[model samples]
Target: MNRIDGGFGWVIVCSAFMTLMLVDGVLFTLGILYIEFLDEFKEGKGKTAWITSLIPGTMLTVGLGFGGIFLSTLVCVGHHFEKRRSFAMGISLSGSGVGIFVFAPVVRILIEEYGWRGTLLIEAGFILNIIVCGAFFRPMQKQSGRTTEKSETKEEAIDLLRCDDNLIYIKENCIPSDKNCTIEENASQDDDVHASKQEIITQTKSTKNTTLSFFSRHFDFGLLTNPIFTIFVVSNCCTCLGFNAPYVYLPDRAEEKGMNKLDSAFLLSVIGISNTFGRILFGWIADRKGVNRLLLYGTSLVICGTVNVMNPLNDSKIYLMIYASVYGMFIGVFVSLNAVILVDLLGLERLNKALGLLMMFQGIATFIGPPLCGKSYVYNLY
Candidate 1:
């Protein structure tokens, strides 16, 4: 019931790991699938991009927003952690790296065996497991204000049916669990809660409130007023803008240079594997005293971006593999530190909404980054 940094917290970590593995694994490997689409459709880079429907932007969006599972899965694991949180988060966030490691080659095989369409179908079915992961995300009984907590709590209620799950104790009132669902019962059981025109208006307002809450809860615009967080968000946007481009371009870039298709695809797996180790290694180091998470995050991104800049320098397959290895390792830090840095920047209380906003911005950049990189190829700009 309580977070002792173990027990169910590890359960949460495992759930987060698997959920993210599905989320990022499938999404990151869109590059392999994109190659299939290019050969199948033979469309321009920019236009074919919308084809991410991971043809470029579409699959990434699907991974990030599909059923709106991305942000919640990310935040829930952190909520269950504290003392060894950096390490726990490292272990959990490494799931993405693991996903990337596993999915790239696996997806390539699926494409070769089944074709892109069948592969996409199989991948969709794979992503459906994210829902199963959500059910395991039992809410923590931490203290917080009712109104402020309602945003995330209600979101979880609607998605997971927490009250009916019987895993949680309902102490007072509805806690946004089943307010309108229980309205009729309330009226029948108590005359003071009579069913009247007021109830109708109340129900209508509640419906409107639900819509507004969903919007505000996920994208709290007020966060921009925090100059520090705003800067962080802006910096994140810029970093992510190019972060995914390598994954999308690597396969095609390799094939263009006459690398074998399987080897080309394996480059992503190299990144994934290195990333897995990097996350655990960096996380372990970050959790130790005297290491600055922000500085660590910046250093990781710097090395990652530097690696990206240097990737194009060598077209040799071995060189590319080396590039993938180094690039993947540092990006692992970026992914693992994402949640931890948010806590350092905004504290735990603001973590949920802050993550939502930050993820949304990252999503926008992600949606545009790869396709633009592809377009550059078309225009001889790269």
Candidate 2:
């Protein structure tokens, strides 16, 4: 496999960018929708929160499980690029940031001009573009020699059958031939043939059993036993516990603090801009700087967590913008580097299963996080 990095891989990136733009753009901009749902449905904060959280939770959990567009894109890009894998993934993942930047204002404007229901309809139209994006993922070609080896193996089996005479002799003897063979000899030959047939049948049964067992061996559930991978999953789930609450509620929080809708929406744009740059910057660094990716990822998470925890303290618009900017940048770093860091930890061979399981766990947290945050808000728990 020669990886043609520039030719088709870049096309895949462009498609992936668009896919993420539509999917994540709508997902992140749900903060705008949060307010709309509150008014339109006349629901309490806790009840309304499920409406927004369901999109991401379903996509991450069920979509990934069944091979969603994003997961398929990631797998394609990983297959296509090796040396520049981090950089390519950074660019591809940065689409979510760009989508957040671009869609936040667009979604707010739609809500203002057309109402929340209209905005949702328009967002659905945008999301349909992922189908177009998916078409660009050309299937990778198989190795040339693989088919040849299979053919050769078949030919060898055929030749061995052709050279064998015992079966042919048995078949010939079954017909009425005028040969001077004794009845005793014929009986012994019949016994030998029946024993050989039974042996072959037994071997065939065992081969089927072995084939079934191969899947379990190859998938290797023992990966969960590794302390590092286990710890990573637990920590990531914890991070998801609060990962989306800010995006969902930040705009409302700003409105409560006397910031207008437009200004609060722009905060997401600020986050998007910084996040876009952070993804590209960290990706470039990971590729060329030889830095420890886990350390970099952890540092970004710390910064993001700190910014989020301090979010309730700032009431000034400018201060909020600054905070949003810092938070966005580190969040971008965390998102862009997530896959690369996993590859570093688990290697590429195990990455698909590792990521699938990770997303499944993260999805559970995503489903629960926003509702909890909304309930907290109802009770002034924060």
Number of the top lDDT candidate: 2
lDDT of each: 0.78, 0.80
Task: Give the poorly placed runs of model 1, Cα more than 4 Å off.
Answer: 53-67, 142-214
Over 138-193, each residue of candidate 1 has an lDDT whose tens digit, in order, gives 77876756665556666655643334332433333544444423334533544233
Consecutive 10-residue window with the lowest summed lDDT within model 2 = 173-182
Q: Each model's TM-score, in the order given? A: 0.80, 0.81
Instruction: Determine which window of 10 residues in candidate 1 has minimal summed lDDT.
Output: 53-62
Which pairs clash in model 1?
52-55, 52-56, 52-59, 54-59
Error of 1 at 155 (Å): 28
